[model samples]
Target: MEARPRVAGIVLAAGKSTRMGRPKQLLPFRGRTVLECVVDNALASRLHRVVVVLGHEAEAVMPLLGHRCVTTVVNPLYGEGQSSSLKAGLGAMTEETDAALFLLGDQPLVTADTINLLIAAFADFPSPIVIPTFEGHRGNPVLFSRETFPRIEALSGDRGARGLFREYGDDIRSIDVRTPAILFDLDTEEDYLRLLREFPAV
Candidate 1:
């Protein structure tokens, strides 16, 4: 029998949230912090391991994850931008990890089912990148194959891995998902309110 790929889930929660004027990762959502919800989803998924990269208000956030089954890492260069946090998370991956599914801390609504869908696609297609699409629009957390790690590691500033899609267009696999949560990442107070209104219970 073929061995299953070891995929890790990396939650990027190191952003300073300058736009929201607060750490969105610590925001309350469904009885837990936004980051907690996102991390919980990742923990429930099929990924072999989970790593959460924290920065900005890491002191306050670290306490919340003390009991969870995740390896947390701090990104001192978080002020640099999303790329730094992305790199921080990637640095925690083990040698056997075949791919990484990058998730956003403020995107608490991205369910385990959505992440599992991406993993399933990678299992079959083994594409350079696996992205989720909602009604033809692409969204995160995107799956990056180990082959693209070097290019991703070379990234800098606030840029995420999306830029690589253009260069690897032929090797990208887009999976259509049923939920719009893939596109509803929280960025401001208005976004938070909207999320509460839509998912008051969970």
Candidate 2:
């Protein structure tokens, strides 16, 4: 039998957070910075590698990951948008990586179980894109197969991987996640407050 493809975790944290008026990744959450919490969850999962993409307030956020085991990559053109960070993260991955799970840094609610479950689904039914869905709603930390990496790298602006869904919708595999955290991300004060109120455990 062939060796199983290696799955890596990519955390997109380079956003400027203009709406939040501050770096949301540095915001306090469960004894650690918001970005740290997200990275930690990915660490606790089954990914073979983890990389955090930084831009905007990279100076401030990079310090928080000082003791982290994940590789940190800086996107010089982050102001151009999320695609820059996505490309930076994917570029930093080792050649052995077969697929990558893209997670939002502002979304600290994602659990390790969800990541492992996504990996499990990918193992059973590998596809170009694997998104988590809750109650018919799609969510992130989206997994992209190696075959689709070239197109994703060619992506420009803030579009991220949305365009891929349109092109590869039929080939996309959806894994049903039980938690709403997959869709919850902190952007403004209200979103952060609501996240805390809705998920008290965090």
Candidate 3:
């Protein structure tokens, strides 16, 4: 039998959360912390492995993820920006991984189904890059084939894989998904309140 391609899930949680006043990943949502929710969803997905890149408040956030089906990696240069965290997470992926799904830790609303859908889409196309789009807008938790890892590793500043997507736009396979969860992220006080009011029961 042919081997199934391995796909890894990467949760980027190393940000400083400067605008949110405190660590957004540690914020309580429904009974669990935001980072916990994100990690749980990633673990529940079909990805072969899940990795979380930690920084800023690693001490507090590290314990919360204890013994989950995920691996934790620290971004020593996290202060550099999101790209640094991306590099850290991708670097920790297992050698068998043929692709990787990159997720932001603050996007607690992103569900396992959404992630699974992206993985399924990648399995079908096996493209260099796969991005989820809702309506006409493109959003994260993007999946990239191992073919693009070299470019991804070379990313600098805060440009992120988005820059690589632009550079290799022709190779990007855009999958349209009907999920508003792609638009949710906890960046400000208003965003937190909106999440609380909208998903009070979680």
- On lDDT, the candidate that comes out on top is 1
Clashing pairs in 1: none
lDDT of 2 by residue, 4-118 (tens): 6689999999999999999999888777888999999999999998999999889988888889899999999999988888899989888899899999999888989999999
Q: Residue by residue across 99-159, what tens digits does model 1's lDDT show? A: 9999999899999999999999999879999999999999988999999989989999988
lDDT (CA) per prediction: 0.92, 0.90, 0.88
Per-model TM values vs. the true structure: 0.98, 0.96, 0.96
Candidate 2 local distance difference test against the native? 0.90
* lDDT, candidate 3, 34-143, per-residue tens: 99999998888888889999999999999998878789998889998778988898889777889989999999888899998888888887889998889978988899
Instruction: Flag regions of model 2 displaced more than 4 Å.
Output: none
Which stretch of 10 consecutive residues in model 1 shows the poorest summed lDDT? 193-202
Model 2 pairs whose backbones collide: none
TM-score of 1: 0.98
RMSD for each of the candidates: 0.7, 1.2, 1.1
| Displacement of the residue 114 alpha carbon in candidate 3, Å | 0.7
Clash count for candidate 1 is 0
- Candidates by TM-score, descending order: 1, 3, 2
